[model samples]
Target: MRRFCSVMLAGVIAGLGVGIGVKAHAQAAPLEVRVVVVTTFELGQDRGDMPGEFQHWVERYPLEQSFPAPGTEHGVLRYNAQDHVLGLVSGEGPSHMAAAITALALDPRFDLRHAYFILAGIAGVNPYKASLGSAAWARYVVNGGAAHLIDSREIPADWPDGFTPLQGHVPDEYPRPPLHSIAGDMAYQLRPSLVQWAYERTKAITLPDNAALQAHRHAYQDFPEALKPPHVMIGDTISSETYWLGARMNRWAERWVSYWTDHQGEMVTTAEEDIALCQALALQAKAGRVDAQRILILRTASNFDMPPTAITPATMLANAAHEENLPGLHAATDAAYRVASPIVRHLATDWARYKEHVP
Candidate 1:
């Protein structure tokens, strides 16, 4: 029965255009690192690029040791023994994410059994729900790139959006694949209580808010809540490499989450790396190399998923760099660090408390 399901699922995944799986051999012992920081391009870039003191424990704890992935250039993993934190700079894409994680999982040097993995990065915010530079704790992560696309001109007139959730379908009518049936079959639901715990621990903290960001926020006045400065919230994420925008795409994002979670999901942030990272971790968990439930995703907004109505789509696309920088990349990164540091400190200082409890 299991083999039949796997073969049938493979055919479906091919049709959907999203491939899955990670190939890694089991090692003798898991890495002892208690906390692992998994970050995309920005966090994984050169250490000198870090704007301020707010950083992974790497800065204060300093790099105690480094493990160089054998077959790759600049794919070294750093560990801070003092704080029990490990860092991986997975380059910015699905491919790089899988490679980095596969290397670490198969390295045979680290016993990652009890390590708590934190997937943190900057994501485009749904301005209607969150402001620039706010941090969000995710309960559900969906792949925006998972959908089958039909050009707007090609799609049937009745279909409201150009995106079809899967092949041979129109908007709102895509078949719902059962769990483990295909790539992005179900929204990878993180541990709800852990998500709540992370948010409750950091929600009260202040985040980056500035006059320039406020002025930008003003443009989103129609989205009352987006007008506020950066803050912390618990929400869901949409992961896709394509930078989609506007009301049409916005509705698609919400629907995408709802489809995968069966009506319990909400799209709060848009990201490019979560699905890839989570998929890799899922593979590791299946091998007993890591605890899937220990993984947490925290995304801070560097820009909005859609520009305010005042801006034209063409202009929004042209000014992509400006939008990515307006709230200041530093501001978003800082917000993530602020909201996540205490959790880091708590875990490191009291590892025993979370060791067996898996909180």
Candidate 2:
């Protein structure tokens, strides 16, 4: 029965162009480091004021009426330098992120070698473990809601009571196969030499006093500029429309759901894009397409999916408002830009080895 269902699911995902298991060969020449940052909200006042740090690159490509498949309708920021080339797409979840990556990979312009993919955005954290303004560096991304209960569309009688067709299941144990944000094996491949290089580069960095840094004492004290250890990555796939229902399910589950509710005071269910993004990254690691040691996912925890005594539209709005404005949120965002730009810049500068690095 499970075998038959698996076949059907494969067909469905293929038809929808949703499953991203296949690899697309790069047509564009390879570059040093190919990095992709997927996010939601192209521009927003709450996140912080922006002279728009990536503006120069965006200006070079500018917005077109359209681009190409998967991303044909979306606005993409593309930049190509002698070092490396990158595409930054805005939008928060799995489908959008997968498509943008597909388009970029398939596009003749991008060189895929020695690539690093990053999903940077706001996330919901476990309240007890992290405060409002804390940042989490994901070591592995568990697909919290990737699996769904199967319902036979053809046989109405086969439908089980109390079960919604195609309804996603939230499992107790963290899902596997783990996506590698930091390629463990690959780090050793580039070890010693790369570590020495990194050491030399980081030796001069002066750690600035920041409130966000103070929050995660164990995580980032002496090495504010250094990449922190692996942390669990959970993507909020819950859409605004279904987030509440997801949150309620979270309450029943209690354990996993607390990560969401504790931050926002409500339940939000749905698979977030970063989860799948990280999953795809795991695939990349398996395929030997990217340098995992150089990759990292830096996210800010923003909402707690806890149910409130008095729930109202205004209350929900306030929760979201607070999530965005939280102290660590800005610090994480700023740190992401500050920390990531240099790596991207380094990859862009060294394009000669692009093909060898791209998976």
Candidate 3:
């Protein structure tokens, strides 16, 4: 079934077959923005007027259209008619992401009715599932943030970790909030057809490789996938505000994703900003401003969720560059562009076919 858009037009004169009249109108034609790539942050952090951020996006889509509203951040809608993709930056973190998305959804500048939104960013990979520099297509986004943490040192002895679900209590108990309760359920399931479609397009593309990346990956020889170079895979993301570390926290994150998604999704990338992105998009969908199902999240791993067995958590954290692997960062970003470009191009070039029927 084709999902046809139903919008009331006010500016144009219709039915002019020898029996129509003209009407006074005062609005320019609504711009049709096909694809909106929402990236969290640009460059080495900080809010600056930088023209370049996404390497592949900047190189491929050089045509930049200024933002249409006031008070919103100064970002352009990058266009690549040749490739059929548009890009935007959502700033960073929970608050910034919420504001940036609200601006775009409510801006009254472009027609986002049929636009496909892609959330592309780097994240910490769960070594149990994948290796550094690998990219993943998420079917579920679980909010590892906004939790009721009691502190591992202070929590009940039997409880798995300090972090607990909203209104949830006790040791190893799943959240059992009231019926239709919106407090505890944080997992957002995106359109599966769209996820599969995007995954199929660029999964074969090789992610960037480097000696540093390989050396770090080698530490996890026990895990088969982590031993290989970065590759594309299907997984879920755990979005948390707390910069958590250690295997205990990793275990909690893994369980949190599964618990929220009903064991349907395996947690892969541990990153920030995804839940914020999901909430904003969900509201926009409810308002009939954008198609919620059209949104997809693609996260790449720049580092592992936790260090290997040989390295102590304290020792690993003490390392000068514990948070990010430079090589993995480059590889992940490179892989993000490679995996997303083809799907974006396909949607842009074949809009007529995918308009109502999701690929």
lDDT of 3 by residue, 1-359 (tens): 12222122322325434323323224554567777777765664222233223645666544344344344453545565554456766666777777878888887756777888888888888889999888999999998875677977898777777876666665345544442455533888989988988888777887888898889888887678788878898899988877777788889998888877878989888888888888888889889888888888999887787888778767666662532333377677767777777777778778888767777
Instruction: Give, for candidate 2, the lowest lDDT window spanning 10 residues.
Output: 182-191
Off by over 4 Å in 1: 1-31, 43-45, 50-57, 60-64, 70-74, 178-186, 322-326
lDDT of 1 by residue, 302-327 (tens): 87778787787667667775433435
Clashing residue pairs, candidate 3? Answer: none
TM-scores, in order shown? Answer: 0.84, 0.50, 0.85
Q: 2 or 3: which has the higher TM-score?
A: 3
List, residue by residue over 61-177, the lDDT tens digit for candidate 2. Answer: 222222333443346455444434455654555666656655555555444545655544555443334433334444333334423333335424533322221222333222322
Tell me the whole-model lDDT of each prediction, alpha carbons only: 0.75, 0.41, 0.74
In terms of lDDT, the poorest run of 10 residues in model 1 is 20-29
Clashes of 1: 7
Off by over 4 Å in 2: 1-33, 44-73, 80-82, 147-271, 279-295, 303-317, 321-329, 345-359
